[model samples]
Target: MFEPGRLHLEHSPVQPPDVAYELIITYAPASSQDGPSMHFQVTGHIAGQPVDESFDLAADLAFNFASSIDHLARRHGLPATQVVPISLHRQYDEMFADIQHKLGRHCGDPVDARHLGKT
Candidate 1:
């Protein structure tokens, strides 16, 4: 249940200065034992034209994000030397909290085994 946010572009010799990119993450409900999946979409404008690409991942969100950025950059013909490491800040704190709450409700939280050892 992630939402699309602002676009940011890193200035590099291989990448056009006028290009901008945005990454969007969305939740995908599945019956797999690994819990929910995530779909990462990278949309942007290159030379006044819109370019969009997406891929589904079942790994950790943070890892998926970085991989998605790299995938998009490569798909758009951007050179590896021009690729920049994207840093996702804590701006989605509230959104993440909400997602946690929802996931907790949908999928029961992990039991604290340490509590079973107590009297």
Candidate 2:
């Protein structure tokens, strides 16, 4: 399920029968000396393990969070091809636009090289 600033994913695998988990991601706009960015908090469990992590994404790159979600899912033992299952693309687009508006970011905006892990 997806809401403006949050997304929740749940999975129950049949192979392990006992395997089940949920992942929730919440994000908001933040600013540091480096500039504006998006702060994200991921909380939930994978199978029987608890998961709690946080990270920040440069505003210009925040829309790519789906890729990050895929990474997190894999790290938690989900299949490599598993990703956010958003049945409505329009909802994702709305969330993207909302984040962009909150961060005042637009296409072609300059991205900090440091945030890109270049330096």
Candidate 3:
């Protein structure tokens, strides 16, 4: 399920037998000190292991949050390719727009050069 500032994903692996997990992601604009960034929290469980982590990303890199979630899935023992599916592209677009609006970011705003190298 995808909401304006929240996304919830649940997955159960048939091949792996009893491994099932849920991932909930919430995001919001960061404080002024964070400088045009978004704050994110991922909380849930994977294969009976508790998962609670948070991170912040600059406006230009915020859209890649899904990839971050994929990394977390791998850390919890799920195969790289078998992570939760974010098939609703439309919902993602909505969430992206919402984040940009909250951050007062425009489509053509200049991106941080340092972040470009990281990508």
Every model's TM-score: 0.45, 0.76, 0.79
* lDDT for each residue of candidate 1 in 76-107, tens digit (9 for 90 to 100): 66555544345444434533444444334333
Worst 10 residues of 3 by lDDT: 81-90
Q: Give the whole-model CA lDDT for all candidates, comma-separated.
A: 0.45, 0.73, 0.76
Candidate 1, clashing residue pairs?
none
Q: Which stretches in model 3 have alpha-carbon errors above 4 Å?
A: 32-34, 87-90, 117-119
Q: Give the best candidate by lDDT.
A: 3
lDDT of 2: 0.73
Among the numbered candidates, top TM-score falls to 3
lDDT of model 3 at position 92: 69
User: What does candidate 2 score on TM?
Assistant: 0.76
* lDDT minimum window of 10 residues, candidate 1: 110-119
RMSD of 2: 3.2
lDDT of 2 by residue, 1-119 (tens): 77888877777775643457788888899986676788888899876788898778777778777667667766876654444454344467777777788898887877666677511
Q: In model 1, which runs have C-alpha deviations exceeding 4 angstroms?
A: 1-35, 46-49, 59-62, 88-119
Q: Which of the predicted structures, 1 or 2, would earn the higher lDDT when compared with the native? A: 2
For model 1 the local lDDT of residue 100 reads: 46
Error of 3 at 21 (Å): 1.5
